[model samples]
Target chain A: MRRLYELLEQDTRTAGLTRVAVSTVAVLVVWQLVSMVVTNRLLLVPPAEVAVALVKEVETGAMWTNAVATVTAVTTSFVVSVAIGIAVGLALASSQALSLTAGPVLGALNSVPIIALAPLFISWLGLGFASKFVLVIMVAVFPVVVTTEAGLRATDRQLVEAARSFNATRLQIFTTVTFPYALPFIVSGIRVAWARALVGIVVAEFFGSFAGFGFAILAASQTFDTARVLGYVIMLGAMGLIGSVLFAALERRLAPWRQE
Target chain B: MSTAVRLKIEAIDKVFKRRDKPSIEALRNIDMEVAEGEFVSIVGASGSGKSTLLRIIDGLITPSGGRVLVDGRPVDRPGPDRAVVFQQDSLLPWKTVIDNVAYGLTLARVPKADAHRTAQRFIDVAGLHGFEHHYPHQLSGGMRQRVNVARALAVNPKILLLDEPFAALDAQTREIMQAELLSIWQETRKTVLLITHQIDEAVFLSDRVIVFSARPGTVREEIRVDLPRPRDLHVKRSPEFSGLVDHIWTLIEAEVRAGLRQG
Candidate 1:
């Protein structure tokens, strides 16, 4: 029974995702189910009509445009956050005074919701990609910084002492011991950051955007097209999910020795 | 001084200030020396300051009083001139075996190709030829300690300091490494100062065994090994070797029993 449960769990994770995916499809299917019960199109568009509407939007290339814009902003912000965050984390972990100073300030910033700062960001940088990118950076950078810092500081002192005994220099110690030791933490931080950055891009687009998944959904909502809006939402979720998996694969490849 | 002194340490003292306690006397008025190219082991109970003596002589820690001179020159901060194989190998996890072995030469600013060639040479000497690409984590503890020895000898220091380098290894491996180290010493003729709590290890490895008294450690007795060169595992079984081991054990029994109580 336990063996069967393990197999069930495995198949469930892979196949069960389809059921969860049915949330957006269920939005389409609900009308058909209701039609049998009440025969209403004015109340809810059928699944076929919503598919046609989604295709109609895609045929105009608007779907691709929204995708490209949101992706560009999200990717840029995520990279910026990862590079700066890890650098700062490593630096702060290296110095006691710097860690003491930066720790509290970063913690305070993390506590303040970025959503509440949307108006301020727009007012300061305008509603262009600049504001959205910064918003995404703000959302993404924290986790990377916190996690990388923890990783650096968490290095085994015994290994470090051993390195010193070998007459290893400061640069050598960092490259050999500290960086590799901190890799898992760095990967975790970046994974969470990617998710946050993607969410930031969508939220930025929802409030104000020339084009994005958020704009597409808002347009669908305005016309009371629940199926199209749900479709866009599913696409956004899929994109973030795929991005995280890709990064996780990269991390695993880079630090395969760590698992043992 | 008939054997000719290889190094001299005089009036060595150390005081470490604990936060709440009055200054603790770690060592005091310690004076000792090793003969030229002699393999001498310092044996003492834990906290008997055996390790501190080696550190001071290695120039990792400066003596609070007095001075240590290697070949008559006062010892300074750690230099490639005096290589150390510590309890911890300190191998960089990211560095491959060759890189870790090559670290000292690189710091000395040796040319890259030459340094790699030199490190590769000693890596072979340490009997770690094919494992050159492996990282510290990739090797067993004994293998890692071999890398540590290789790293120290890579610099070809005039003297070598070992602080129980094999204490972490299993008994069987320790015996094998002891033989390897003995052969290495025969080849390099390095004046070695090793510290260990193991009586048999101290007896088996050294040309002279310097035993220390209980805490605020002072040199209790420096029994000459009087054994022949190329000492083997069977040497421990010989009556002559056991005689020296028993003599040193008698001198250190009080401290060793004291240590067992606290530990």
Candidate 2:
């Protein structure tokens, strides 16, 4: 019976992969049909043209430059935002006075449409990496702060009492019980922050930047280079996909006990 | 059991006050003592505040009126001298069995190696010898409670306070765990104060059983179990054991009915 169940499970996994492949092919076919029917290269190029443009950009090293710039900006902003946000989050969760003062301010900031501030940041910081970095931090930091605080606040009361019964000091309880308990929440926050960082970097680049994926797309669209625009968009999508996969793996590693 | 008192609860009373609501008298004028190396159990109806009394003695909750004394010293705060196994499984879910067992020792700043070594001995005592690397989520309810007990024993506290530690387990597991707990307690000879609703469990493991009345809880009676130690499950089948269990159950049942009538 166990062997049969294992075999059935393998069959379902194989079927899932087959379905993904079939869906991709179907989408490509539909794209080809639409492109052929339209026959307007300026508006909608076929997937083949987009792929050719991608290769050409890579051959000329433009793709590498743009990829390197966006990757660096996103990673640096994400790291800084996570560190500062977690520190702020821990402070707010630890003290009622701090949370009461700062929590509503953060909630208001989060409610603002972050993209609207991109131009202001670029104007102030002078259309440079600093503006993009600041924009990404503003966009990405709130999720980390909010989720980290929520996670810490949700630490099990019974567990804390049990720790106290063993005479665990406050710091010891936080480190051993509270922090580890909040890890899954922190990782999820990082996931949201990552996607927001991508969006922020793109918006910052669009407002003003010398070079990046968003800049390349903006430049391509200005000249009606639809294929190149599509190529950069696909690259951004792939980056988001890779980041999401990595965060999911990290969540599993950090919180294996949370598996249902 | 030695005549020396390991724990003394003197006139402890607890009143819980809520905003916009009347105050609750949870425990009233409660007094008890546990001798050195004695296994005592408090059996009471629901809402009898027996668990609250255990928390007061563990120093997790302050008594509104009186205080708890451990070894001639007043307990104003939770300390290493007393350890508690809460009703709920309070294992650190992220930590493995060995790490969870060593948690108290680690908090005391025992070097990691020494803590793990001591934890290993208690793990063996708790009959969790081969599952050192398993997480709490991966263990059965009975096994988790075993780890809970092991964590408390690793600290080697002056007194072990268990608040219905096996209440969440199934009947078979509870009985098996009860037998194992008796063996472990016999081997360690630690002074233990347990709060349980299970009358048979109280009779099977305790040297003395203290019955509490319905809330505003107070000690209604204290029954000394004359049964011998090193007890196995078969002893639970004895007529004497059943008699003690029946007597305690009658007391608690009356309290339960009374509480229901008042409610």
lDDT scores in order: 0.82, 0.91
Residue B116 in model 1: lDDT: 91
Candidate 1 C-alpha lDDT tens digits along A1-260: 56644654553455456545655566557757876676454455556666777787789998889889888888888899999999889888888999898889997887778766776887888876998989999988999999999999899886766555546678887876888889878998899998888778888887767788887888888887776886687678788878787777778666655657
Once model 2 is optimally superposed onto the true structure by TM-score, how far is the C-alpha of residue B22 displaced, in angstroms? Answer: 1.9
Deviation (Å) of A114 in candidate 1? 3.3
Q: Tell me the spans in candidate 2 whose CA falls farther than 4 Å from its real position.
A: A1-30, B261-263
lDDT per residue (tens digit) for residues B1-263 in model 1: 24778789999998887898888687889888787888889998788788887778777677789898887888756666687788865676667899888877877778989889999988888889899999788899889998889888888888899989999899999999999988888888888989898889988888788888867888888888778767889999999988887887888787778888888
Candidate 2 on B1-263: residue-level lDDT in tens? 57999899899999999999999999999888899999999999989999889888888888899989999899978888899988998999888999999999998999999999999999998999899999999999999999999999999898999999999999999999999899888888899999999998998999999999977898999999999867889998899998998888887887788778888
Q: Assess every candidate by TM-score.
A: 0.85, 0.94
Model 2: per-residue Cα lDDT over A5-119, one tens digit each: 4654563556555555666788889999999999978989999999999999999999999999999998999999999889989999999999999999998998898879888
Model 1's i-RMS, to one decimal, reads 3.2
Stretches off by above 4 angstroms in model 1 are A1-58, A162-180, A224-227, B1-4
Reference-based lDDT, residue B106, model 1? 77
**Docking quality category of candidate 1 according to DockQ thresholds:** acceptable
Q: After aligning candidate 1 to the native by TM-score, how far in Å is the CA of A161 from where it should be?
A: 3.7
